[model samples]
Target: MSNSIYDFRASRLNGEEEQLEVYRGKVLLIVNTASECGFTPQYAGLETLYRNLGVRGLVVLGFPCNQFGAQEPGDAAAIGQFCQANFGVSFPMFAKIDVNGDNAHPLYNYLKHEAAGLLGTEAIKWNFTKFLVDRNGQVVERYAPATKPEELTPAIEALL
Candidate 1:
């Protein structure tokens, strides 16, 4: 695995390959999301943050995952529609991915390794686990599933 997130490439909801290099100079909030999870409402706060801080170089990237309780079972198209219709999410969203286990996405594997969760464990416990990446593609911090999006503003501002 490469040292930075720029070394990764992920498929967008539309099925196009997206290079993380495109966001090289921007602060990023990368979250593993689940539409049916209890924390799903965080999507609204995430969208709000994206709209408010985006111009200042904060980009929120949502990655739907179903590894927990099968909370996000929808296909890419269905997930897109659910997000748009429910939370009005306008930020970039990627295809479904696994955040834990042997099948985890490479990008996510790097994130978990960079910033471990409570008790210094690397595995993601649930949906909505967020990884904050700096402009230089460094994984600076990892927010737990229950951490509200608003709580990240201070750290995000510092990076921006």
Candidate 2:
């Protein structure tokens, strides 16, 4: 795929549009999340990372999904509330979006193509899969579902 991660936008939980291009010049961690999944607790770590590094040009974007075992069945409003109450998450969260399937969001499709996972597989295995993008809008790395957000601090720091 083309190195055009900027050519995408996603619907915000608050019913607004967020252009991916607006994040230019920043290192980004894009994740597919699930509130009830095994990796759900990573939300706390992600928020910690975001809060600590946001001013350093690092941003973590969360996109909740139910594509895996119905782990995230809440609608936009519920998902937002749950995150705020449980994890104190303050990162930008997009509306519920499918990460794998015919209805998958275009931004995610680009991520998979740019940074395939284990054994060169491009398909996302489960929830909490992460894609790290560089400041130039290139997908630079892919982390597994179990990769905790805290584990990526070094990489994120290096990029910034």
Candidate 3:
């Protein structure tokens, strides 16, 4: 069995295959995003962090998910455009995925198993839930949906 995030592969927003191993040596902040959620504005903060610290080996990856109240109902092309137009988000975005179910993306399943949430629960509670992975591709921590992106700067910096 795979031990780290590097074992995963996902499709990019454009439908091209993306191997997580490409980001092997970087600090990763992986997020389950939704365009219409109340926390949607956090995209700006995520972009800011990516821009400021990206060069320092930090990579923020956004995975749009529609499982939460149908907040992200658009298809890949539309979702990509929405993020670019509304938040100017430039971080790597994967195709829309199910984050909490039998059909959950493999990477997310791995993440949840690695860092369970409050009370040691492995299920993701809502959109914007974040996972921080270290340079070695090990899941380091899981952030609740209410945890603002800016609040993760120190932890990200430490990993970088």
Candidate 4:
């Protein structure tokens, strides 16, 4: 099993394979996103955090998922275009992938295992669920889907 996110590779929005190792020393806010969800506007907040704190080693990684309510039906190209057009998202975004069940992405599996959700359950409850990682690549905390991205500034700052 991979010991950390740095050990895994994911397909970027453009279909390029990227090693998470590139972010080895960065604090990451890994989020599972969906375009049609109620929390979709959090994209703006996430971007604000990324733009504001990215210089300090914060990297917000967005991974779109459609597992809940079929919210993200768009393919990679559409998802990318939608994010850029709607929210001006500039942070790195990956191809859509399942965040739960058998087809779950390996990186997400690792995150859920390392940091279970509320009630200690590992299954992701919804889109926009966020996971924070320290610069060392260890999972630090898991935030529910309802937790606003700005609300995480303190925790993220602590890691930076």
TM-scores of the candidates are 0.98, 0.97, 0.98, 0.98
Model 2 lDDT tens row, 1-160: 5567788999999989988899999999999999999899999999999999999999899999899999999999999999999999999999999888899999998999888888998788999999999999888899998888889999999999
Total clashing residue pairs per candidate? 0, 0, 0, 0
Give residue 125's error in model 1 in angstroms: 0.4
lDDT of 4 by residue, 52-144 (tens): 999999999999999999999999999999999999999999999999999999999999999998788999999999999999999999999
Residues 63-83, candidate 3, lDDT per residue (tens digit)? 999999999999999999999
lDDT of each: 0.95, 0.92, 0.95, 0.96
Model 1 per-residue lDDT tens digits across residues 1-160: 6889999999999999999999999999999999999999999999989999999999999999999999999999999999999999999999999988989999999998899988999999999999999999999999988999999999999998
* Residue runs of model 2 more than 4 Å from their true location after superposition: none
Return the top candidate by lDDT. Answer: 4
Q: What is the C-alpha RMSD of each candidate to the true structure, in Å?
A: 0.6, 0.9, 0.6, 0.6
- Backbone clashes in candidate 3 total 0
Model 3 spans > 4 angstroms off:
none
Residues forming the 10-long window of minimal summed lDDT in candidate 1: 112-121
Per-residue error for 67 in candidate 2, Å, reads 0.4
